[model samples]
Target: MATEVLFYHLTSQPLEAVLPGLLMKCLERDWTVVVQCGSRERVEALDAHLWAFSDDSFLPHGTAADDHPEHQPVYLTDGPDNPNGAVIRFLVDRAVPGSIEGYARIVLLFDGQDPEALAEARGHWKSLKAQGAEVTYWQQKPNGGWERKA
Candidate 1:
């Protein structure tokens, strides 16, 4: 089975601003999510952001170090382990998973302002395409919305 890969180019907003909404969408679909980031610092920062991203909103999530990983609707980790049994996986800040096929959907969010991040995303896109994955590229619009470019 080919995995559906989505590349989100972040320009108008930071990951903290956009991630909660995306995770919320997944939750709406009743799909558990695993968010993998580049470093422990990034993971911790995201965990904090998800809790305080909005005054009126809150995303129930926890780090790998937190207790009861299987109970978390959204799991955050620096490694590529899926203890939460998530069907959707989010790769942000250059965190590459060991295999994309295991997940139903894979979202790669990269910072557009960083040349290194852009190049890495491009490489991942080409690799996944070559591997016969269904891939889509979404560019962030000026209004902080996403537009599918490819």
Candidate 2:
């Protein structure tokens, strides 16, 4: 099966607000997820954010250094390693995956405010399409909802 590649253009909301919900959706489907960022600092910050993103909600996640990757429902890292055997991979903050295959879905979330991020996302879309992956582009609407653009 071809990997489903999704590009999320962050405009109305920051990743902190959007990511938790997406992760929750994956978890509801009984799918483990791996979120990869560009730097350790970013990954650490995300680890903290996921813990306190909502007062009523909790996301079961941990970093690579935390160990027990197999126990975590969601894993966060800066490297291109999938220790948890996640079915879905989220590439955030311009993080590029070494390979898109094997995963059931691959999500690329980039900031619309950054020109460089947008350019990188475009290149990724083209490359993934060329690899025969099913690609979808989502744009954040003014109401903070996402709309499928392509």
Candidate 3:
């Protein structure tokens, strides 16, 4: 199946407040997720954040530094490798995906307040569109839900 690429422009909330919900949705669908970041610092920060982000619960995830990455429902990395065999991949921290094949979904979540992130996302959209890829853009609504804009 062709991979569906989604660009999520985060306007109403920051990533910390928004990511967990999306990951939960993917988990609900029984899809292992790979969240690729731009740096090891980000990997570490997310590793800790996912653990303490929730008041009553936290998303079960691990990183390459973990003993068993393959068993983690959500695997965090800064590379192109899919250690957990994730069907849905998330590209964050301005991390660009190397390839879009062999996945059910490719989600790019960018900060709407960052000019550079916005520009980079636009570039990705144009490049992917030119390649005849199935791409769509979604914006965060005031209510913190997603609204498809393209």
Candidate 4:
């Protein structure tokens, strides 16, 4: 099956703030998630952030150091492996997977303020669209909401 690609252009908030909400939505629908970052440091940063992002609640996630990845509802990694059997994957920090297969959906969030991230996201958009994938683009509105642009 073809993977649906979603481009989330972040202009108002950082990934640390936006990620958990999306992950929560996925969990609400009973969909597991794999969050892929570009480096180990980013993975660690996100790991820490996710744990403390909210004071009211927390998302259930794990990393390689946590062990037993197969049991985690959300898996954070710098690599491409989906140990948690997640049907959906979120790519951040300019991380690109080796293959888009084995995923029902792929969400790519980029910093609208960073030129590098913006360029990389556009590249992925063009590449994936040319390959006949269903791609959509969404930009953040002023109130921290999303509006589909494509």
Candidate 5:
């Protein structure tokens, strides 16, 4: 079974340089990486690159009900009012039994602030971990980016 790792970083800093390296690692291990970025354009661009790397890779956006692959990298928008709304629901649903039963692991990434978003995400993380799923978290700085709040 693949180890589930939720690698998330929320900062004003662009993850363009960092993401490729991370993806490369996942590819090496043949791990299914579920990534969520706040910016649509950025995620779209990343998706394009991902497709170039792996034809089997898929990036579907928006709610699962309306989710359809658009080109490559899957990007989702958690609007101010809807943060942790659709994506969280989708992950929780997928993590449930039978849906993605064979999935060795589940990973969730999100902006680590916005009390509402983090609260909801934390709940899901805790529940999954309690069920024996390895849970990990990284929080970004609240002032401007995901830096340590100190």
Candidate 6:
């Protein structure tokens, strides 16, 4: 069973300070990482920078199966309407039988600044738990650096 690691970040502010080490850990274990974020350009920028160490990192944009071959990070969008809803749906959709295989783990990276995004993330966390997927979340503090509170 493949592990589904869901990283849901509200923005890409602290990803540079946080994700590199975590990403390395996943790569070492051959775990697939799905970084769902609101900023596509920032996420891609992070992806381009992180490839210095490994090239297996990716973000799902559609039905693509780990489609990114380069070191660039895959980009997912969270537009205006139901921003958080889109993320929850993506994770749920991926967890369906045969949709994703192997050990499944999801890492949700979110920002604490946005009240709306936070509330939506918390609610969606419950939905994620109900779906039988292990979820972990991290938020970047105002001073910088990632803090895992849940």
Top TM-score hit:
2
Query: Which digits, one per residue and each the tens of the lDDT, describe model 5 over residues 34-90?
Result: 454444554456556544544565333332223443322333332222222222211
Error of 1 at 66 (Å): 1.2
Candidate 4 Cα lDDT to native = 0.92
On the 0 to 100 scale, the lDDT of residue 20 in model 1 is 91
Which portions of model 5 show Cα errors greater than 4 Å? Answer: 1-9, 12-18, 32-46, 49-100, 140-150
Expressed as tens digits, the lDDT of each residue in 1-150 for candidate 6 is: 433445455444544556566555655664444444455555455545655534675432321223442332322333222221222222211122222233345455555566865676777666656666666665555555556666
Better of 2 and 4 by TM-score: 2
Give the worst 10-residue stretch by lDDT in candidate 5. 89-98
TM-scores for all candidates: the values are 0.97, 0.97, 0.96, 0.96, 0.44, 0.50
Clashing pairs in 5: 11-146, 47-73, 140-146, 141-146, 141-147
Whole-model Cα lDDT of every candidate shown, in order:
0.92, 0.92, 0.92, 0.92, 0.42, 0.45
Tens digits of per-residue lDDT for model 3 on 5-65? 9999999899989999999999999999999998999989999999999799999999887
RMSD of 6: 8.6
Model 1 lDDT-worst window of ten: 95-104
For model 1, what is the alpha-carbon lDDT of residue 126?
93
lDDT of 5 at 125: 61
**Candidate 1 lDDT tens digits, 10-129:** 999998889999999999999999999999999999988898889898999988779999999999999988888998999998997568867889999999999999999999999988
Measured on C-alpha atoms, candidate 1 has an lDDT of 0.92
